[model samples]
Target: MSTATHTATRMATSTAGHALGDSLTMLRRNLKHALRYPSLTFAVVVTPVMMLLLFNYAYGSTLGAGIGGGHYIDYVTPGIVLMAATSGALVTAIGICTDMTEGIVNRFRTMAISRSAFLAGHVVGSVIQTMIGLVLVVGTALAMGFRPNAGPVEWLAAAGLLLFLTIALTWISAGIGLVAKTVESASNMPMPLQFLPFIGSAIVPTDSMPTALRWFAEYQPFTPMIETLRGLLLGTGIGTSAWIALAWCTALTLVGYFWSRSVFYRR
Candidate 1:
């Protein structure tokens, strides 16, 4: 190889190594914070469990009868899992906002570390935390008599979809955090995302909603995602919902990734 080519290769390798090491360091920092303050994680886990109980006991029988005599728990579990992931993502926003306001970001900027590493760390760590919350919600659902006939492939697909959604939203939450003036605003900004499931196919069929709400619930991202997950886990017909869900997730992930990068660099 030419000397110029060798030099270029060495530069690329060094940059990649630095990025990896910096990201791992930031990941450990975020993980330590999560461990030190356990209440936030506990709150994220508990909210979905509470929702599961409320829906299953209070509204399950009535709603189950309307949905063709199948157990409501089976129908709603997927949505609740998504909800749990969404709830956990809120913490990413708050954490990022806290870092921004506390001057930590400025210190990082002065260092020679990779600029993107901190955000990457938060995104990866948040996804892992969300998965834990999702497992807890799924376990609770199973104890509440939710059952699925999904084979290994189907289960794997469902897990992939959940992880994709978590990453997409966590990126958006990180952007939201960067723009907020304070941690309180950062926390409040993600409130609408958490409530989206309630308006979609999470608790009841979109058709049962009013005509206007039906239109929204049908077209919104959450419904298609929940439908796709239901199809995978319960063997329901996915039809076009799978494509629509994938499109939404991909579009959102790209948009959030770019938006966060732009905002972070501008600050």
Candidate 2:
């Protein structure tokens, strides 16, 4: 290669390396914080588990009868899994907001690190934390008689879908955090996302709702996602829900990513 070309290649490689290293450093920092103060994680995990129990016991008998009377826990487990991830993602917003407010981000800005690494760290670390919460929730569901017909391939697909959903939501949470003026506001911003499952097919059939509410529950992003997970794990037909869920995830991720970048650079 020509000298100039080789020099450019080396420079690009070095920049990529630095970016990766910086991102890893930030990820470690976030994970350490999660380990040190695990109450938040426990809180996130507990909400979904409690919901699972509440629905399975208080409402499961009545609700299960509506959907054939025996597999309500199976039907609701997918929704609770998503709920767990959503609950964990709320912490990403709070953590990001706290970091932004404490001037630590300003210090990072002064360093010769990747500009996106700070946010990327939170996103990656949050995904991992969310996955752990998902596992715990799923385990609890199984112990409570939630059974799935999924084989290895189907189980892997369910895992991939969950990870994609987590990443998409984490990005949105990060963006919300960036836009908020305070940590409290950031924590509150993603609250609506957690409740979305209730209005959708997560806990009950959307078809049973009133016309307008049913229409919304049928068309909303979470419905398709919950359907897709149900299809994967319980051998239900995915139909168009998989495509719709993918579209929602991709669109939300792109919007959240760009919005966060814009807000971050502006500040």
Candidate 3:
């Protein structure tokens, strides 16, 4: 390479390293903040656990029969896990909105750190925390007699898919936070997303729903994701649902990230 080219490459590498470092530092900060204030995290973890228990116990008998005598807990755990992740995504918005409203982002703007690191930190940290919460949800489901047929490889793939899904939701929530002028608004904005999966095949089979709702449950983004996750855990046929779910996840991630960045720049 020419000397000029070598110099540019070195500079680019150095900048990328700095950005990663800064992002990690901020990720630690976000995690620490969660540790200090456990209520939000607790709620995020508990809400889905409660839902899982409620659905499995209160309605499991009915729903189990509805799905051809299958174990309701097994059939519903994936959806509940998605709910937990979405609940955690709400925390990302609240954290971001809180920072923005409290002038922390202003302080960040005054610093020399890479601007992207702030969002990256929030997104990454939220994913880590949310994954931890997902584990708790799954454990609870197991305690409730949920049994999955997934082997080690399937479990890993399910974890990977959940991580990707969490990332997508977190980014979109980040954008909502950036756009919201108040923390209340930020919390409210992603509420629909948290519950959207319920409208899918979360509680029961999509085919069992009314015609219009069934069409929506099948065509909406979360149904394929839930189905793909169910397939991974239960050793069922994934078919094209995995591809469709991945496409939705990819599209949401891209849209949320750029949308967050655009709003951040404006602010």
Candidate 4:
């Protein structure tokens, strides 16, 4: 390679190395913040657990533990994990938005920090926290009679998919948090996103819905994610949902990354 080309390559590597280190440090700090504020962290984790218990108790009979055999609880556990991740990312957005509004973000901007690292760190941190919450929820579900037919490897894949969904949505939420003008707007951004699953396979099978709604229920992103997740967890074939889920995750992550970058530049 030419000297100039080699120099450029080295510069790029140096920048990436520095950025990764900064992201890791920021992530550790945020993780510590979560640990210090146990109540807030506990609240985020508990909401989904409460939701699962409520749904199983109140609507368990009506829903009837779903088609694949075990209690609907087993079938629905993946959806519960998605819901928990969604809920957790919503709070993630609000917290980031608050930091931006209160000048914490600006303070970091002035420091010798990688711009992307700031958000990437939080996104990584949220994924870690979401996984912890998932473990707690799964423990509760096991107690409530949910069992996984899939072996450890498949179970890990199921959890991995849930983590992918969490990371993808957390980035989107972070973008919303970064761009939203007020705390209320940032907080509400995830509400509509959270509601998407209600129309998908999360609560009921798409085939069970009316024709029109079923069409929507079948194609929505959350349906595919949930379907793919169910497939992994239950050792069932969810067909196209697996591919579609990956597509949706990729698309959302790209949109959020680019849009949030633009928002940061504008600010």
Candidate 5:
């Protein structure tokens, strides 16, 4: 390559490294904040854990039988887990909004750090927090007799899928945070995402829903993810649902990323 081209490549490489390094620094800051003030993380874990117990103990028998006389807890574990992931996404929105309100982004702007690192840090940190919460949720489910037939490879695949879903939701939540004028509004904006599993195949099979609801349940973003996860965990057939779930994850990630970038820069 020419000297000018070589120099340009080196600059790009250095910039990318700085962005990654700065993002990790921000991640540590958020993680430390979560550790010191764990109320929000506890709150995020509580809802899904409560739902799992209520459904598995209070209504698992009926719902389990309704889903074809199998263990309801097994069928619903992935949905609840995904719900936990979505709940964690709320942290990103609130955290981003809090930082913006505190004028932290302005402070970040004055520093010589990468511009994208601000939001990227929140997204990465939130995904890590969410994944940790998911491990707790899964442990709870397992304790409650939510046995899955997934082998090591299957478990790995399921974790991979869950991570991708978490990333997508976190980005979307970050965007919502950027758009919200206040912390309260940011918290409320991501509510639909957290509860979307109910409208999908979370509690029961989509086949059991009424015609219109069933149609939507089959096509919505969450269903495919739930189904794919369920299949992997239960040793059932995944068919093409894995591809569909990835497609949704990709589209959602892109949308959230660009939206967040545009909104953050506009401010």
Candidate 6:
């Protein structure tokens, strides 16, 4: 190949390598934060389990038909886990905003580090942490008799979907982190995301909701995600909801990523 072509190839490879490296470093830093604040980790890990018990025992009777043709808990566990992932991303955003406020990003900008590495790292770290939380929640469900009818491949597919959802939301959360005027608002940005599930097919069927609310709930992103996840875990067929979920995630990731880049450059 020509020297110019070779140079371009090398530069691309180096850029990709730097991005991956930054992600790893950020993951380590976040993991250290988690280790230092074990209480916080414990709270994030345990809160969903608590939710399961409270919802299942207290309100399970009031809930309608299980989407999975099983107990309500079995149907609701995946949604609860998705909710947990969404809620847990709040801390990740808070951390990013704190770093931004403290001039950590400025310091890194002065260094030889990759421009997008730090942001990429935060996203990667958050996804990993959310997956861990997911495992704990799933294990808790199994212990509580929440069985998945999905085979190994379907289980992997379901896990993959959750991971993608988590990563996609992380980008949106990062945008919130990057643009919030104060740390408080940045930290609370994920609150609305958590509530999305409640109005959707997460807690109850969207058809069961009031007509006005049902219209919004059925069209919202969370409904598709919850329905897709519920179908996978329940070993049901991949339906239109899965396509809708993918589209929503893709749109969110692109919009959030570009918005964040613009904000980051402006700062």
CA lDDT, every model vs. true structure: 0.92, 0.91, 0.92, 0.81, 0.92, 0.81
Error of 2 at 63 (Å): 0.7
Model 6 stretches astray by more than 4 angstroms: 64-70
TM-score of 1: 0.98
* Residues forming the 10-long window of minimal summed lDDT in candidate 2: 82-91
lDDT of 5 by residue, 103-220 (tens): 9888889999988888878888898889999999999999999889889999999999999999999989999998899999999999999999999999998999999999999999
RMSD of candidate 3 to the true fold?
Answer: 1.1
Position 245, candidate 2: lDDT: 93
| Lowest-sum lDDT 10-residue window in model 5 | 64-73
- Name model 3 segments beyond 4 Å from true: none
Shift of residue 237 alpha carbon in model 6, Å: 5.4
Count of clashing residue pairs in every prediction: 0, 0, 0, 1, 0, 0
Badly placed stretches (over 4 Å) of model 4 are 1-9, 65-70
Model 6: pairs clashing at backbone N, Cα or C within 3 Å: none
- The TM-score of candidate 3 is 0.97
Residues 1-267 of candidate 1: C-alpha lDDT, one tens digit per residue: 999999999999999999999999999999999999977788788999999999899989999999888789999898888899789768899999999999999999999989999899998888888888888889888988989999999999999999999999999999999999999999899999998988999998899999999999999889999999999999999999999999999998999899999999999
Off by over 4 Å in 2: none
State the displacement of the C-alpha of residue 261, model 3, in Å, after optimal TM-score superposition.
Answer: 0.8
TM-score of 5: 0.96
Structural similarity to truth (TM-score) of each candidate: 0.98, 0.98, 0.97, 0.91, 0.96, 0.91
Instruction: Give the better candidate number (1 or 3) by TM-score.
Output: 1
lDDT of 4 by residue, 1-267 (tens): 999999999999999999999999999988898888766467667877887898788887678645544477876777877777777767678778888899988789889999878787888887787778878988898899887788888887787788778888888888898878888988788887766787887777788889999999888789899888888888778898888898999998888778877887788
Global lDDT for candidate 1?
A: 0.92
Give the alpha carbon lDDT tens digit for every residue of 18-88 in model 2: 99999999999999999999987887899999999999999998999998777789989999898887897
